[model samples]
Target chain A: AQTVTQSQPEMSVQEAETVTLSCTYDTSESDYYLFWYKQPPSRQMILVIRQEAYKQQNATENRFSVNFQKAAKSFSLKISDSQLGDAAMYFCAYRSQSAGGTSYGKLTFGQGTILTVHP
Target chain B: DAGVTQSPTHLIKTRGQHVTLRCSPISGHKSVSWYQQVLGQGPQFIFQYYEKEERGRGNFPDRFSARQFPNYSSELNVNALLLGDSALYLCASSLAGPTGELFFGEGSRLTVL
Candidate 1:
């Protein structure tokens, strides 16, 4: 079984500053994917970024990027120039890339980190 | 393109009652997965349906069941509901593969009294 962990329960950052949310996972599978999702007060889950375990390079989506250290089993999300809109609950998720019979589209998520961006 | 959509944005029911939640996948999507998100915790997988077939099931009790329709729409049913069953149910859809990118619906908030 694969499990994701988000150590920080709450985080705060000033507007225009940068912040990093930490996440770690335990999985025996060599091929997998990592994702970060944001949930606003409106309760809508939005995809922030993704990283493929095979890819040594980190994944970056505009202001959202990830520091993926496969050897350390760490995948952290970094938010640059944070805005007030970034204030939300962020979750780190894990997905298996196995083929055939094990092709369930299930995502194992971590206990979310509540991010607060101060103006 | 329309993302995954769930019906009955909010539902209230009493203990021992049964409830059903519906979900419509994206136009070209053939995979639909259901999750249960309790307050202060991350969402937990309940079931996954692909091409109207059951692909996977989580560690939920037998009272919780689900099925997919020909149109790729799905329904999650909870029988003999208990107060512990109250949570936000979410439906997610994706292109039929293992890319791991999923579009989620606003979720149906179920309140069991």
Candidate 2:
């Protein structure tokens, strides 16, 4: 069983500043995927960024990026130039890669960290 | 392209009653997954369906059941719902299974009285 942990229950960042949300996971599988998801007040879950365990390089998307340290079992999300729209609950997730080439989309998610972007 | 869409954005049900939630996956998407999100918590996986077949199930009880239609639309059914079942139910769709990035719906908020 894989477990994702987000130690921070809530975080706040000033507008136009940068923020980093920490995440750690426990998984024995060598091939897996890590992800950060954002859920706004609208209650819609949106993918922020994703990183593959096998890849040493981190993943970046727009202002969102991940610092994936496979050896440390850490995958942290960094949001640059944070805007008010970035205020949301962020969740870290893990998924094991299935051999059938089907992403076994069953995700183990952390408790989540509520992020508030202050103006 | 349209993302995942769920119906009955909000519903109120009494304990012991049954509830059903619907989900329509994005066009060309064949897989649909369901999750339950309690207040102040991350969503928990309930079930995943692909090609109208059950692909994977989470640790949820048998009270939680779901199915995907030929058109790839899906429905989640919960029987004898408990107060614990009162939460936001989310439906997500992807190209395949969990390995891929999921596109999630706005979610159906179920409040059990």
Candidate 3:
């Protein structure tokens, strides 16, 4: 089974600054998917970004980018020019892409890190 | 297009009671999955249904059961509820394939008393 870890239980960043949320996973599969999801006070889980294991270029969505280190099993989320709206509970998730396996499409999530963006 | 939709946004039930949560996947999506998210914690996978069939299940007990309808909508049924069953039940939908990207619903908050 694959497990995602987010060591930081809570993180804070000033508005207009940059912050990085750490994430690591334990998986034996070489091909899979990694993701970052954000849940705000409204309690809605939104997808921030995603990274495919086979791709080394990293996945970026505007202000949200990921530093995916496959060999080291690390995938960290970087938020640039943070805004107050960026404050939320961020979770790291993993999914297996193995073609005909029982583990396919099951997402394993981390404990989540609460991000606070102070104005 | 409408995103995944879950009914009964909030509900409270006592111990040993039975509860059912419903989900309607995004249009054109043939796959739906259910997850449980406790307060201050990340979502935990429960079950995944594709093409009206069970594809995967997490470590949850048999007390928790789910099924998908012909319209791609799904329902999660929990019997003999425990206080530990209190959580936000989330429903996610994605295209039918090996893809991992999923669109999530607002979730149904269940409080077990």
Candidate 2 DockQ category?
Answer: medium
lDDT tens digits by residue: candidate 1, B6-112: 99999999999999999998898889999999988899999999988889889999999999999999999999999999999999998888884799999999999
Reference contacts preserved by each model: 0.62, 0.70, 0.60
> lDDT of each model, Cα atoms only?
0.93, 0.90, 0.92
lDDT of 2 by residue, B1-113 (tens): 78888999999999899999999999998989899999998889899898998888888999999988989999999999899999999998888644567889999999999
Give me the runs in candidate 1 sitting further than 4 Å from their true place.
Answer: none
State the displacement of the C-alpha of residue A27, model 3, in Å, after optimal TM-score superposition: 0.6
What DockQ does candidate 2 have relative to the true complex? 0.64
Quick one: best lDDT, which candidate? 1
Clashing pairs in 2: A103-B98, A103-B99, A104-B98, A105-B97, A105-B98
Best candidate (score: TM-score): 1
Candidate 2 stretches greater than 4 Å from native:
A100-103, B97-99
Give me candidate 2's TM-score against the actual structure: 0.96
Q: How big is the positional error of residue A115 in model 3, measured in Å on the Cα after superposition?
A: 0.5
Score chain A of model 1 by TM-score against the reference chain A. Answer: 0.98
Superposed by TM-score, candidate 3 places the C-alpha of residue A69 at a distance from the truth, in angstroms, of 0.8
